[model samples]
Target chain A: MYELIKNLGTWLTSGSSWTGTDGIAHRLAEHLQYSLLATLVAAAIGLPIGLLIGHTGKGAFIAINLASFGRALPTVGLVVLVFLAGGLSMLPVYVALVALAVPAIVTNTYAGMTAVDPDVKDAARGQGMRGHQVLFQVELPLALPLIMTGLRLALIQVVATATIAAYVSFGGLGRYVFDGLAQRDLVQVLGGAVLVAVIAVTLDLALSGLQRFLFRHRTA
Target chain B: MTIDWSWIGDHTDDLTTLTVSHLQAALSAVFFGVLISLPLAVVAHRIRPLRGFLLGVSNILFTIPSIAIFVLLLPISGLTRTTTVIGLTVYTLVVLLRNTVEGLDSVPAKTKEAAKAMGTRPLRTLLTVEFPLALPVIMAGVRIATVMSISLVSVATYIGDGGLGQLFTDGFQRDFPTPVIAGVVLTILLAVVADAALVALQYVLTPWKRRRA
Candidate 1:
């Protein structure tokens, strides 16, 4: 363990490791691009579908079952499958990561929207609010906490899965771990593991804080 | 770039072997996860402090990416199924434990009181009443964990212990799409099949819930 930590220190401190095309910064950028693109795409697709289904109380079956189905489709398998079909590029990785992410967002959005107090929604309607206004102004705010929760879950999963994109010869922090494993370099493997963990932790904490911010209105 | 159907068809034996291996690795994790989590969940449900600690630990474990967990364990267990299963089991613990506690907690207080008022022993009341009532929700958690384990076992291929994941790696290396596509479909099917079976089991166990009002 000491030896592993020492190697990681070497990897972290070395100038070459931190710069150039194959450097940590480059890999970090690659990881972030995949994660951000996947998250954006998933949110764009999931939030709308979730809000629509959730508001109407329609397609509950699809919303609920989609979560399990997404969970079941192995992310790695999906990555490989897309790579085979779409060619060997980061697009396959993005598609796979997006698939992993969308379900959580959808399910949470549905649940959050559904869980809003009916009286509150009825009041919004009983007032002069139009349908879209009621949905956007009242329901969305009420459901923000849960929606944020879903986003947080999806983001973490995407970040985690993006690491494995390295397996397909894509650039990411996972490349460090896999490349290290190939060469029997424990330092590289641990360095990559630590970096991914840091990303996951930071992302989760940020989302949790956002969830709290969204939630503040609830009790107030 | 295109699939070779004949290649996949000729590999039926290989497919079955891989499927069973995947099932074995994943299911064993779920089985032991339940065994380990149920008791802890049961006790934790009634004890608020313990509940938080258990959930906190499991949640932290859950955050560790699947492949990271496997790689983290590689040093300790050295690329064996032991490391893979342990990693898988850790992932299942949070899901199972939370579901178990939630299901048990959802059982009506009145029902427990009624069981006790009937002169039933506490342990028997818990076994016959609380557990049966909790089974449906608990099964839901089991379904999630099982599906997750099945999906994750494919990632375990990195450590040389992939179940259907081996097909994925092999297909990629050999420049063949057949095994890769087959592995993807089979993994998804395994998840769906397990979920359906669990749903059926839940219905069987919770006949009261099935009755019309």
Candidate 2:
């Protein structure tokens, strides 16, 4: 155990590990790039659909089923299937990650929007607010917490699966784990896994903090 | 992409074996997750200060990615089925504990007081009165955890222990889409089936809820 820790410490602190194409810096950048792109795309697709169904209260069955179906699809299968079908390109990774993320965003956004008090919405409407105005000014603000929750969940899942992109010969922090396994280097594997965990936890904390901040007024 | 029906027909036995193992791993993890979480949730419910701390820990555990958690356990548990099961159980604990705690909280205080007035012991009250009332919420948690475990077991393939996930790695190495499609379809099928079963179980267990609905 002691030796494992020492080796991991050395691997993490080694100057070579922080520089060059294979460095942690480069890998982290790739991880964030894939995660960000997939999330933005998922948000673009999910947000409008979620808001639409949530505001109009129609097509909920389809949206709910879509969420559950997306949840059931394994990340690895999606990536490999897309990779094989789409050829050897990063597009497959983005596609898989985006697919993985959309359901959470859509579900949470819809839930958030629908959770808004009907009376509150009615009050806004009674004050001569238009449909879009009520949705935008009232529903959106109240639903921001759940929407952010969905975004947070999607981003975290994307970051995690972004490592799988490395499995398909793309660039990301997952390269370390796969490369380490191939070479039987426990330090690299552990170091890489630790880094991924750290990033995930940091992101979770930041987002949760933001969620709290956004809803500070709501004791519930 | 076109699916090879003949390929699936030829691999029925292999698919069945993999599916069985996949379900075994996911179900066992969920079983253990509920077993462990129920006690912790009960204790957390009783101890007000401990509730936040326990929930926070589980939240952190949930935040750790599936692949990362599996790999993190590799050195300690090795690349075995045990490692996969343990990693999955950890993931389930997050949801199970939270939901269990929330379920316990949702129990009506008036019900507990009425039980006390009827001379029920605290333990008896908890087991009889509180638990039955909390079943719906707790069952919801179980359903989510079960589906999550089924999907997450695929990540165990990286550690050499995925059940149906093996089909995915097989297809990838062979550059064939048949097994991959099979794995995806079977996994989703298994998850949906499990979720449906839980919903049924909840319905049967909460007849009062059904009547009210």
lDDT of 1 by residue, A151-199 (tens): 8889888988899789889888999989998998877887888788788
lDDT of 2 by residue, A1-220 (tens): 7899998999999999999999999999988988999999999999999999999999999998998788788989999999889999998899889999999999999999999999999999999999999999999999988899999999988887788988899889999998988888888988988998889889989989988987899876
Q: Name the runs in model 2 displaced over 4 angstroms.
A: none
lDDT of 1 by residue, B1-213 (tens): 667888888999999999999999999999999999989998899889899899988877787788888888877898898988999999999999999999999999999999999999988987999999899789988999999999999989988998999998898787678898899889989888888888888888888888853
Considering only N, C-alpha and C atoms within 3 Å, which residue pairs clash in candidate 2?
Answer: none
* TM-scores, one per candidate: 0.94, 0.98
State each model's TM-score restricted to chain B. 0.95, 0.97
Fnat scores for every prediction = 0.66, 0.80
Which candidate leads in TM-score?
A: 2
lDDT for position A135 in model 1: 88
